[model samples]
Target chain A: MPYELYYWDGIQGRGEFVRLALEEAGADYIDVCRGPASEGQGIYAMMAVMKSKSEAHIPLAPPFLKDDDLIISHVANILMYLGPKLDLTPEDQGARHVVHGLQLTITDLVAEVHDTHHPIATSKYYEEQKEEAKARAAEFIDNRMPKFLGYFERVLRQNPKGPAHIFGDRLTYVDLSLFQVFEGLRYAFPRATAHLPTQYPHLAALHDAVAKRPNIARYLQSERRIPFNEDGIFRHYPELDKNAA
Target chain B: MPYELYYWDGIQGRGEFVRLALEEAGADYIDVCRGPASEGQGIYAMMAVMKSKSEAHIPLAPPFLKDDDLIISHVANILMYLGPKLDLTPEDQGARHVVHGLQLTITDLVAEVHDTHHPIATSKYYEEQKEEAKARAAEFIDNRMPKFLGYFERVLRQNPKGPAHIFGDRLTYVDLSLFQVFEGLRYAFPRATAHLPTQYPHLAALHDAVAKRPNIARYLQSERRIPFNEDGIFRHYPELDKNAA
Candidate 1:
């Protein structure tokens, strides 16, 4: 059976992170909610899966991968499972552990980005907390962005093999994630992102390299890859962008 | 060789989250930051290990666990490692996924609690962010606490066997974490927490059950379990607490 990815129908929120990895790996998978043939998912469907009494044994949340018997949830956890199968992680345990550490760091950065908009409540609208978002965004652009990006760039520049990949010479899921993060920050904060591009040349190169990969390139151009929108995690909130130092 | 848990010596913050599970399992481990002379630990030694670059790998922050060759960082990841060792997870893969999902949810809640005080910037002092923290804390107390707590309560209530554990009748690391969340919230938001004494009674009972486990009781009484203080994640800033819920 093909991998089953359950997530919100419209947005490329957390689920897209998992989707990108699967798509890049050329893995046979189904986007459950989007196709006409497949059943659409809403919050209630998600709740029913969680709350409904079933021997089905529900995974934590959407974006869980059911390949054969393994049910992996937690965006990072799913990636951890796929990393080896798809050859997205380094073969060495130490390198793999470091890559995992970096993935968890990305998880932190994503959470921070999500919090900038949903500072008050996850269910509440971004408009409801615009002022808080403004305050939070100021910190995000000036402080958090550089801190996370700086760390990633540092990992790239300091890579003993070369500055080409995050872990070592070869591409890993983190390289893909870094591409997403760079794409996301650039989309979400163009003004700040533009000036800071040259500072992390290695990271910029990795982002470009990942984008240029044949499978990922095709996925990006295909209708399957959702466009970045306000509904997604990487939204172009002009107010959040600021001039970089 | 014993497992070395490298973390802050002062408070039962994130590290304690890992400690509770390890304790509850009665697993043979040493708190590398704080332990008796026979047990082997000291503050200076822990900090040195955290900051030392001589090692092949270094965590960006503490709460990193070392089991033989495995040096796992991140609270959830460490618990993921311990969950299996301690039999704190289900035998089935699907069940393990649900437990991991619940674990990640706890991770989200912990982040929210941290944001209640550091809504501005992690680098800034609580005093510096006091004004913003107050506004953020209000939203958290009024909205987030209920939403997260309600979700966990639902997970418990939805369990087929009973509402006792996160996954099923058998105890998991998530149950140990639920205990910590309750303790933290009760300390940080005593007024608000009291209002829900019986709301999540099963979760409450689970918390009690985990705490009373002989190993956890020994750890608590053995001067290893640090008291909640201002330095930890769940700090009680009187101005931020709910005077009356």
Candidate 2:
């Protein structure tokens, strides 16, 4: 059976990380929430699992995956499970843990990115927290962004296999996730990230390389790739994207 | 050789979650950063691993565990590795994944708690962002706290074994971590959490039970259990603890 991926229909958000891995691997999966309820799919289908009392494993939030009898949640946890199955990770146990660590770090950066737009409360709207967001974004662009990007760049440079991939000689799910992060940041902080090509040469190169992959290129050019919008974790607010002038 | 845990010496922070697991399991481990630099076991020792060129698994931050040749970071990742070795997780693969997912949920809660004091910039001091933090903490107390706590309470209530433990009949590292979360929240927001005992009776009971565990009880009263202070993730600032009243 094809895996059932349950997430919000509109935004890329955290679900995109899981989606990218599936897309790149040419894995057969259904975006459950995107389908109609008449077919036993949609938000209600996803909610049924979330609210299910029969299942011992309960998901705290969405972006959960179901394969036959097994269910998994948390982007990193789900990706870790899929990575090996899809041949997106290394064969060695130690190398697998390193890739998992990188994925967790990406999750950390994503959380910080989400906070830049919603500094005070996730429940509140962006307009309500616009002022605080401006200040938060300033600090993020100045300090946190460089810190995280630089760390990834350092990891790439230090990779024994080469700087082409975040891990060994072959492509891993982490490389794909990094490509998505590069896309989201460039879209969200156009002005703030204008110099990324020069500042993060390895990351820029990896991003360019991932975009050229046959499966990923087809997916990106097709309607499958979601547009970055105000509703997503990485949202563009010109006021919040300003760099020091 | 015993396991080597590298974390910040002064604060419990994220490291405490790992420390609690080790303490509860009665595992032989060294708090690397807590020892003196003369013996190559202070902040420098932790920094050395972070900056080391020889190791393939470079940790992005602290709270990394070194077991023989393997080095694992991220609290949940380390706990997942330690869970089975320490006999804290179920033997079934599916059940183990559920436990790991639950631990990841706790990690999510802890991150939100940290943001209560550092709402804007983590690099900036709490005093510099007092106003923003006050607003953030208000929402956390009113909305996020109850939302997370309620989720865990539901998980407990729905457990097939009973509500006595988070998973099965025997205690797990999750129980120990939850106990720490409870202690930290109580210390951080005394007034805000005064009604927790009544509102979340199961969690309160779990907290009490974990404390009554002989090893854990001794750890709590010992010097190893660092007191919650302004430096830690959960800090008590009266101005940030105001509830609806």
Q: List the residue pairs that clash in candidate 2.
A: none
Tell me the lDDT of model 1 at B58: 52
Provide all candidates' interface root-mean-square deviations: 3.3, 1.5
Off by over 4 Å in 2: none
lDDT of 1 by residue, B96-201 (tens): 6567767887898898999989986787888998987997888888878887887777777767787777777888888888989999999998887886768777
Model 2 global lDDT (CA atoms, 0 to 1): 0.90
Evaluated with TM-score, which candidate comes out highest? 2
Q: Rate the local accuracy (lDDT) of all candidates.
A: 0.79, 0.90
TM-score of each: 0.90, 0.97
Residue pairs that clash (backbone atoms under 3 angstroms), model 1: none
